[model samples]
Target: MKSFIILPALASLATAHYDLVFPEWRGDSFADGASQWIYPCANVTQEKSNRTLWPLDGGAVNIHMHHHWTYYAINIGIGTLEPAFTATLTPELHNTTGNGTLCIPKLSVPAGLAKEGDNATLQVVTFDSFGSALYNCADITFSSKAVDPTDCKTDGVKDVIVGAEAAKTSTDTANTTDAAPTPSQSTGGAAASFGGAGAGVVAAVAVGLALMI
Candidate 1:
């Protein structure tokens, strides 16, 4: 019985929930909140629901502003940083930071999050605790392994590969999709061919075909 219980206990410790949140972030600029640090604390639950909030281990989050931005990071849920996890953003480049912020200037509901209601990033981290990132002097140098961190806390690390890729890909797809044809812009005769009359007639024909198909 003792042996049987050991594996289960270890497994449970091996996995923990991570949740993070900034505030409502009431403005269109990062500068509005740049002076104050928003201390994030996890609001955690094993319960499954649209409104379950996970707790962060630290009593209240400690954040600061450096350079041109205010930054915050929370474990969201606990997990090993031995191998970092990945989260994606649609129509944007992969963030490559474990510390995520809402990016007030480019705020939008994260693609599939509409059913859940409001969302935000709250902080920006472009590198890992090990120091490998799109931007930075690094918290730690990536070598055989980075089991600890010096400059930055190592709750865990995250890669924005998926989010960034989705953002860009979605944008590209949208640009190509549902576009109005510019055949009218192609030739010197474009004015004679399309800029003349019947442009509405052409649009109507296109719509009719789309509906039929």
Candidate 2:
């Protein structure tokens, strides 16, 4: 009976979703995992008073992934209230494997997106292998002092491959060469590689926790 009970609990942990680590979460969603599914900010309507000071040029975004594989998209909204997420920070959806601390250092802020002393919100959307979408966000204040790149590090994570959805979109675009390009495609956005910023290197760090589950 004890063995049976433990198995289900372990399974739950193994299949858990991810959490935004850097900046800061709007509220505590870890206690009730299902709440993370709530759209646009995981049901956390109010922003916290203590916002993280992100670099005006760009900064790091870190997350703790529970799934062995997941897809991620990052976006930014400029404002103090109900800011519209008008900018996508990711060039394409990132497909990552392994489960632990995953960090993207030096994610470049688009030109004129925001300036120092502006309050903005950083949003991270994710999809697991099961195709479930989860949302998490961090409230930030742009600052001239940049975050140290060394602060961003991974414990157990790796960029496995191009995201399936992104790959399909690329193929579809190629097929429709004459079709008008989407705003995202036209911008030539940049994607910050996992583990290091813009290195474009696939890396796998040893798992730190005894149980990834």
Candidate 3:
């Protein structure tokens, strides 16, 4: 009976969604704030520094989702600026359901923006068919030397391919889904809710610790 009970609980976690797990969290992120939903890099305190050097050329990030989602994006901001770079995440299996994992096999650093010891923020966000959205922020430092992602092992993490394949110049409304419906960029406008930020470039991350019921 104990085995049966434990198994179902684990299964529930496997399917229950809503969390962001990667790129490491900024100071007190997503803490008691609704506006952080709109401002990906909101309320960040760069008060502490991390010695971990993220390779600019070939760094890989991991994401785990309780259920499948329609849209995933990665946005980057340097220093005190708004996000300037956006990329969409494409899973090898599009339009999936149930619990799954997505991985960013590699990260592309913007030219001339990231040098050794530069501070930047990466936002990993996602949207569901219900138009509800989830997001998180990571504070990172640029490494001068390129690192090989092959050395980085995320055993349980799936590789979510990142690129500009689904990117659009405008965050305006458009249907770009392969099968599942795509989320709208505007707030309360369509299938997906981006909190008035629109559906531009963003990334999705799921952390088991921050699961939302």
Candidate 4:
């Protein structure tokens, strides 16, 4: 009887997932859980009919998370056909908790990697507490206009620094006289790094549950 009850609870937890809230998703990832682990753009073979106009200087990335805690890595690729995702937008792995809208206000494109009128794709990789890597993408065309600041607001969320970052923060606090800033004060927004092109492979980990749309 206990085993039967535990099975359903585990199933519900596995089904809870996230989606790209800003820009636009390539396809309906929520249709299946297995497809979310497909590399590049969650097995999204073709580009979307409409492309979002992203700011040339930098832009916002918003995602609605369902996990209580998750780690994120953002990347970008330039092109319309089989674009190489050589640019990593997040400097380091960012961990956050509470499960709601998580927004990175401004993520600048790597220097000289892209320019006005160029087409590109934004990829977001998330590692959930269950040790599963979830993938999602957004198609965009670079423009001079900026995304609305209001679009980057967060709700019921908190940034968490773990491992080496936690150690460094502890040491810094000991040496400083000022009070440490809260997690809400420093959200996840960092400069991007553009390296050479490489094939971005998606991990095929089986999590037997459907993704929430």
Alpha-carbon RMSD, each predicted model: 21.4, 11.5, 11.1, 9.2
TM-score of 4: 0.72
The whole-model C-alpha lDDT of candidate 1 against the native structure comes to 0.26
Pick the winner on TM-score between candidates 2 and 4.
4
lDDT of 2 by residue, 36-123 (tens): 6766777776644358889988888888888887667777889997587777787654677888998887789888888889999887
- In candidate 3, which residue ranges exceed 4 Å CA deviation? 1-20, 27-38, 41-52, 80-98, 145-213
User: What is candidate 2's CA lDDT for residue 35?
Assistant: 66
lDDT of each: 0.26, 0.68, 0.47, 0.67
- Between prediction 1 and prediction 4, the one with superior lDDT is 4
| Model 4: residues with Cα > 4 Å off, grouped in runs | 1-13, 32-34, 129-131, 161-165, 176-213
What would the TM-scores of all predictions be? Answer: 0.19, 0.67, 0.49, 0.72
Worst 10 residues of 2 by lDDT: 204-213
Q: Which stretches of candidate 1 lie over 4 Å from their true place?
A: 1-64, 67-87, 90-103, 116-124, 128-213
Determine the C-alpha RMSD for candidate 4 after optimal superposition of all C-alphas. 9.2
User: Where is the poorest 10-residue window by lDDT in model 4?
Assistant: 189-198
For model 4, the local distance difference test gives 0.67
**Where is model 1 poorest over a 10-residue stretch in terms of lDDT?**
133-142
Give the winner by lDDT: 2
Stronger candidate by TM-score (1 vs 4): 4
Ranked by TM-score from best down, the candidates are 4, 2, 3, 1
Give the winner by TM-score: 2 or 3.
2
